[model samples]
Target: MESRRTAVILPGRSYGAYVPQLFFPMLAAQRRGAEVRALDWKRLEELDTIKLDKIARWVSTQVAPVLKDCDPASTVVIGKSLGSYAAPLVARYGLPAIWVTPVLISQDVVDGIKDCAAPRLIVGGSADPVWDADQAFQLSDRVVEIPDADHGLMVDDLARSAAGLGKLATGAEHFLDSIGWTTS
Candidate 1:
């Protein structure tokens, strides 16, 4: 079946090929009839390349091409934590990104972007110092802040219902519709 939505998920900064459990929310988007692809954080591996030439090559030759491959009309990038740095890269390549919980990127990186026109959504919580509600609101037209949601967001989930973490999407269709994501 042809996928109506191409949701590219970028995992947070966890050593190795580890994908976080928070990625579960993206499954919600998928269940709503979106095609989901996880961008292995491991693939980027080391952003801090010791070799100047290698660093330049990765961004231009490796990173740039991958981001550009996504078709803009059907794509939405969900970047969580460290992966947030990738949003701008994706935007530069023509895809919009929704930052889940952003971690600050280098000044050089921010300065590199001449323009940021991608459709963005920033979902954060009060407890995430790296991504406060105000910052998120400023960065994206849509921002959802969960009550007492922490950087991990698991604390809030556990408080609500420890056994029901995956249940966040029980009414996901309605939630998505309310957020302007139309289902076919």
Candidate 2:
């Protein structure tokens, strides 16, 4: 019997799966024949952003059910900003991940990424306060840092931001290929 490939998308507090950053990746995974599950945090406003532990736990709770039966080797997790709190869960499952604008300031988030042994791709912007380029490089060999982009990976120029997204997509594709996740 052939095993299944699963992709879980976790959106940031204000960023939904429909946003360009996530939407494109979701489409990429779907095109690869992986079952994609995009999670929407309905109660995002209620969560305390300052409490790293709480956010991590909440993220895990929300994603637990979706990943319950997934095989770590065949599963890929994609998270952005606040949703990066799921790092611990990804680490625990030893699953590959794409972290966009991850919260580098949070120790929990940093620690989780460090603990995860699977291949990971970290993308962020130089202008984003929460993004630390040096730290990102330390965590993963696959890193994409967009110049002058903010937390949304958007630059002063709309066209430039769009181009940045393109760069992100290319990076993601390369990472997927490196991990041998091909279209079925």
TM-scores across all candidates? 0.67, 0.94
For candidate 2, report its TM-score: 0.94
Residue 24 displacement in candidate 1 (angstroms): 4.3
Q: List the residue pairs that clash in candidate 2.
A: none
Tens digit per residue, CA lDDT, model 2, 100-159? 999999988999999999999999999999999999999998999999999999998999
Where is model 2 more than 4 Å wrong at Cα? 48-53
lDDT for every model? Answer: 0.53, 0.86
Q: What is the lDDT of residue 31 in candidate 1?
A: 64
**Which prediction has the highest lDDT against the true structure?**
2
Q: Write down the lDDT that model 2 would get.
A: 0.86
Per-residue lDDT of candidate 1, residues 52-78 (tens digit): 334333444434545566777666666
Pairs that collide in candidate 1 are none
